[model samples]
Target chain A: MNEKVAKLYQERLNRYMTALDCGKPDKVPVSFGIGDWIVKHTENNFQEIFYDWEKSIKAVDDILPEFDVDVFGGGPTLWWPPMWDAIGSKLYKFPGMGLDENSTFQFVEEEYMKAEDYDAFIANPTEWIATTYLPRISTEFENPSSLRGISALIRSSVAFAEYNNYMGASWGKWTVEHGVVGQFTGMTKAPFDTLGDALRSMKGILLDLRRRPEKVAAACEVIVPHNINYALSGAGADTRFPCFAPLHRGSYPFLNPYQWENYYWPSFKAVIEGLWAKGKRTYFYAEGDWTPYLEKIAELPDKSIVFDIDLTDAKKAKEILGGRFCLIGGMPTTLLTYGTPEKVKEQVKRSIDELAGDGGFILGAGGVVMGDAKKENIMAMLEAAREYGTY
Target chain B: MSEKEKKFVPEPGTCTPWKVKMEELGGIPGNEEIVKKDWERLDETAYNFLWFWVHR
Candidate 1:
């Protein structure tokens, strides 16, 4: 263990934790949501890098340090293909499944949970995921009927645990070795998001929200505990960065304020409150534009939640959220990929000026860096943070 | 791209000390065309997945 290397890692961790604490650090912490873009940028093939931990390590190399941000990324965030294959998934198209060799994995949105089956799902969330969801998606578990899908579910869980351990250790090593903290710990999907994303597709959830509102609400109540469990289960909880919960499908376009406040938000809030009660302060990736629901978002206990949001103006987000929650991103992904480095720098500057007040902002893109995102622009974003982000 | 301001440059061995060439970070020279095609197709799916993690 190199003393200086450990010191660098500590320094970066403190910078990230300070920002997460809603206090100004020496500089604004920057982390890119670069997912599969790393593999695409590298000469590595998607299948090899996506599945093999060593291959992914080689694929990502020191790209994180090369760009040099306060926080590290390009972790093995992708769920392994073996699990997907075991499930015989129709939802995602990996490198060879439905996509070409060069592209990142793609997800296809389709209904997996039906409206009428809300009670069955709510009856036992784990059982529903195991018996109902698993068999529906995969051929192997097509007969979870025999053991009530308990065996298959157990196997899948075991596989996930093993795979996650391997990937977590491997990717986590790179982040630490490069003297950077990762972007997130655990990923707990907000209950409503869990419904919309995992069980029900957008169409299904939207229709359920309209026709069977109470049932949808009931289902989310059951999902809250599961979300909390999943988030705290991430490997790096003991470190500087805690876990993260992702709230999805609650944006204005999908649901009005009333719908979001009622159906989507309560369970999501429960996930936050539940995790907080257990002494875990997790970042909430408030997916989609949160302009309509910033007030509701502000109600979370101060400095206990990270409101890493998208599409909303940083100035307004700061005004609304800066007091309580740390803001994680402001640079738009499109701008990072398509615009020049100067434009990227300007965005970084504005975000720092607006959201980095006394330090409560992590400077980065609005969403996961797309495959096409220019590295120069990302470099510029980090450089801009150093220039304008100093406290 | 701007004047070198007083930024927090890490001490020698402060960052990734065994610094590999920046290119080792990965860059596909001519794949910009593939990136474009993949970009257009994945734009909606990507954002959609961001909001909906329905992918297995």
Candidate 2:
């Protein structure tokens, strides 16, 4: 490690530790991670790069160097096709919508489970992820030889961190130098969101929430710990901080507060407590309105972090959670995508004004970068943070 | 008073339809009685009035 970067890392880590407890640090920390929206902005032809890791990393490398974000985050595992692939699903692309625009790989071949087969499906998920799903990825990416070659190429590539440990080392150094604290692990979605993607059919999960409440709760209980375990396993003890990106998606507005309390809250509590036990402080990226559950979340270990709450007003969030946990994010991604640079800067300034008071605040977009977000707008957010994020 | 001019008065101490639906679904377990008490505080007119007021 560069001596300067090492010093910076220690300094920022100390500051973050102090700030986590509601104490003011020497300076406010700023960081950014890779999100799908920013990826789209960097690539002219994202679809082509989506399947090709080399191309995708190239796109990321172009942006990260310029952005100088405090923390670096890895992209989603493209090891398999779209998530549905695990369940014998495939995706078809529609041009112009970007990577997320792809349609599900239809379950036309055969139903993996009968309605009665739900029990069998729950008993073992590894069978699905390994035999059923990984085979498809092996078929698509066919070159273990080619992958090895690409891995070597990435060693030389600026965006090589997807494959090499250098990115982590460099980011660790950047955090110290910039006086920014680094969150070691990527974000975890809420258990319900994971269920929608990995465990049940999206429609099946939503219907199950209404029709079979006990089953939904049971399934959530069974699955949430695994998600927490998965996150912790990736984040070794060396990195004390654990973070998750829990996108709310359809599950947010669709479920009433009653369902949220029974199904979602318990699962969430289990994960948070589980991570806390492992000596990891969780930065939960709550992507939707969490106002109804604000009190429930406030019960988490003090000094945990919550990011990007959608519908909950930040002032109210601060009132509810300011003392208990550090609050990060609330800047609307829409303002970055559709609004002018000036608008983006103004919103960032507003976020700093509202949430960055005292301590326990970081700034970021409310959600992942969308495909439409202009490059200039993203830069404007960074610029605004630099100019106004002072204590 | 005209319909628009009439002051919208909500039933005091009532639960909204969402709360009612939640109860019917067995969503709120231990707090059912408390929810019911809060629900019973309002008449139908006041209930609807406050329902829109709190939710909207």
Candidate 3:
């Protein structure tokens, strides 16, 4: 960690903390994240690098030095090799879906749950964990070859974190000694969402809601707390802030708004409240038109962070949630990909000027940076934040 | 149909018996109607999620 880089990082973190309170910072902080598949694709290979801990760290290090985002975070989904090992699923590369690391048990296998199985799923979840889940990782230990692969994955995550901190020293000034890296864990979804994943096949989950509402609710109740526990445990109970992304791909255009609220909101509320009570704040990434759920979300007990919303207007979001909570993202990934740098900058400035009025605002691409998003546009977003995010 | 009743279509591709039941006593759309409504209410949650990403 370079002394100068450390100072820059510390100053940036301070500014960010202040700005989150709706106060001006010395300058705005910027962060960027790229998925592993994207990195593998860009590098044109996946073999050992994906499993190489040092290379993983370098991959992030290479990006942060130039991009200079305040926080250095990674997805727990990517980190938990043990969990993947337990599942015994192979990571299949899908052209557009990113990486498809299929789960070991066919969670949605036909006739596995003939009402009686549902009874068993609800009565003792550990049974499900033991039968359907734990085998994925436990098997790796038994198989030496598989164990080696698992070991590499674990080592790589450790290395990734180590390098993240080493590199973070450059960003953190002396007072803030290391990179502020946060990882997502225990991401509980709406009861319906959990039910959708657990009891029903993707299609079954969707259809079950219309056909077997009670069963879905029962399954959700049984599973949602488990997810909440996992998320909190992964994030750490005292975590001041944790990030969560619930990819509502099918739920969005497919489900009607009314059905969404009744089935999903309670589980979401329960999870948010559970985390909040434990003194952890959440940074929820609203993947789709959460526009339908904004009013209910406003009722949260504490308004600590922002929502990284996609396909929604930040200005409108600010109007609805500005006084209560901070606002983070809104720039469209597609716009960033296709638009000119100036156009990107203009959007950033508008977002900042309009939403950053009383403070409590940050800027980012509306969604994750896929492989296709132009690197230049990402830089443009950073520049615009720096230029306009000043006090 | 009444506004609340209108909200009670069977879940997307299935019959009415398959939907998740809303525990919230009826205001409109029974429990099903409120799922979307409750999601919309999360503007603050959304705001905070983005705010942290940008600022942190």
Winning model by lDDT: 1
lDDT of 3 by residue, A232-253 (tens): 6434344655546454522356
How much lDDT does candidate 1 score? 0.68
Q: State the TM-score of candidate 3 restricted to chain B.
A: 0.27
Worst 10 residues of 3 chain B by lDDT: B47-56
Clashes of 1: 2
TM-score per model over all chains? 0.82, 0.68, 0.69
lDDT of 2 by residue, B1-56 (tens): 24323222111222233454553465765767776555553333232221111111
In order, the Cα lDDT scores of the candidates are 0.68, 0.55, 0.52
- Report the C-alpha lDDT of model 1 over A176-263, residue by residue, as the tens digit: 5666667666567678888888678888988888898999999888767656655664433443455756566976678877898899
Report model 1's TM-score to 2 decimal places.
0.82
Model 1 misplacement above 4 A: A145-158, A235-240, B1-56
Please report, as a residue range, the 10-residue window in candidate 2 chain A with the lowest summed lDDT: A103-112
Scored by TM-score, the top model is 1
DockQ of each: 0.05, 0.01, 0.02
